[model samples]
Target: MSTFEGHVYLDHHYPPVLWNIVRGGFDSVGLLPDGEKDFAISVSLASMLQNSSASRLEAELSLEQVRLATTPNSVSRLRGVFVFDDIESISRIWDSNKWGGHFIDEYLADVGVWAKKSTRVDAAWIDDIINNQGKLLPGWEAAAVKYWSGRPKSKDAPIWEVLVEGRFCIWSMHSKEAALKEISAIWPNSLGLLTHSMNCFGLGSLDGQCFAGITGNEAGISIDHYLRMIDSKEAEFIEQLARLPAESPKFFAGKPDLEKMCLPDLTGYSGRICAKDDTNLTALLNLLSQLKNETGS
Candidate 1:
């Protein structure tokens, strides 16, 4: 029921196939996740809680490629990555404001306007689309229907609404700041600069995981530093959840962690791999996946 407008980052590792996925077109509605219903619902709920009119509920996803090495001096090869959203700006807006319901209502008044701009239809047509009873309305009608129906009836609603409501979590952003701030707080003596690629933003929820990744970034730190910060953030999120009421849907199983979240790094092994063949992306990918699995990443 509450609005959490934070940035989310999604990290996908592999060969440079992200470009293929983007060119293939990332459709939100048709490709429902197999086991992430809760995350999908959280996003649907978050959409209703947005401060702005989002008539185009479909998500925009893109990918970026980065280099990975096992060590600082080792040669590095390409890995697919993306910076899905810069949540710092939006997070400030939703977190600072107390107008949860008030803002949503205000934005609803413009949902028609948003639809008009996106679909290039007039107010009359927009109304017709919303009021339409047919199985299919027209161009973009299905998207409009999903958006309109998903609007939160009150500040709170049942969790099952996600099934009937539509998938809106595709519009979330997982902020890198979640890690940055927590790391700073936990390890005040640790000095490092962390940044993201800011190239892509996407949302997905599978197996209790709901996240928006604004992909890209090498966490310019050692493996120990990266894991330490990740562990700290997990603790912080767990603590925050415990303080909240049990009935609140805002608290979900997925809290950004090493398994679901990835920070770009050059490991010592990767550095050695680079030495074998700087251009061998396959070798680089194999090692990266191996490291990820071994570390439970």
Candidate 2:
């Protein structure tokens, strides 16, 4: 299968929780979990900070708590959690590698959270942990400060470099068929599978309904047929479904008019476009165009 390598960042809160989930998830599934599994996963702690009420000090304490909680467990199962506060700081830490720096900066921008300071000590500590432990994450570098004054250029490079260097290649697969084959080859007796379409986003009546189907599938349940069942509901619901697309006409148009259309909730995966009653129809058309290009729908 073809593989595309890109850097992934996680919010600080994500690693501790995600590690618990992955560890718990595999143990529950009876998979032969190992240290290598940690390398397969990368968590972006920076993303978690967007909604975090924890101050920097609180965040530091939280990390220590997680480390303390998990230390007794097998270190091999510990996944790496990379935390950064902002893009500019990350750029400085990475010695200005535009590719990795830009990728992270742009990602944070799109997600609406950028670090404001250099979190260097965080990166160093993670690096020390990984080094002392036998490289729990194969290709992943320890989380590093996105910015720090007088930071050595190579002291910490962008996490994406490891991805590009083929550390997580085992987890990379181009297509559903390839992924299935790879997984089956690895776990011949596995009977269930889960997949998520990252493309799904937004909330509104129709959008929320659409996400019901998306999330259901992600959770290893069949949902397309169920969605068809919803189509047969009351005339009111059906009519609303039909009107929902038209309500945000700009999503279909070549250029999206965000000003005219109400934002979708984006919490769920329905992927339905939504707009306000007074939204400008022309703007909706523009947004529709942009969406079509973005999704190639």
Q: List lDDT for all candidates, in order.
A: 0.23, 0.25
- lDDT (Cα, tens digit) per residue for candidate 1, span 1-297: 112221222222211111112111121211233332111212222222222222211111000011122121111111111111223323433554542332331121100000000111111222334222322235544444333333322333211111111122322112223333443453333222111111111211111112221111243211110111222235654454444435443333322333324433323212111122323333323443442332111
Candidate 1 overall lDDT versus native: 0.23
Clashes of each: 32, 43
Q: Number of clashes in model 1? A: 32
Best by lDDT: 2
The best candidate by TM-score is 2
* Reference-based TM-score, model 1: 0.18
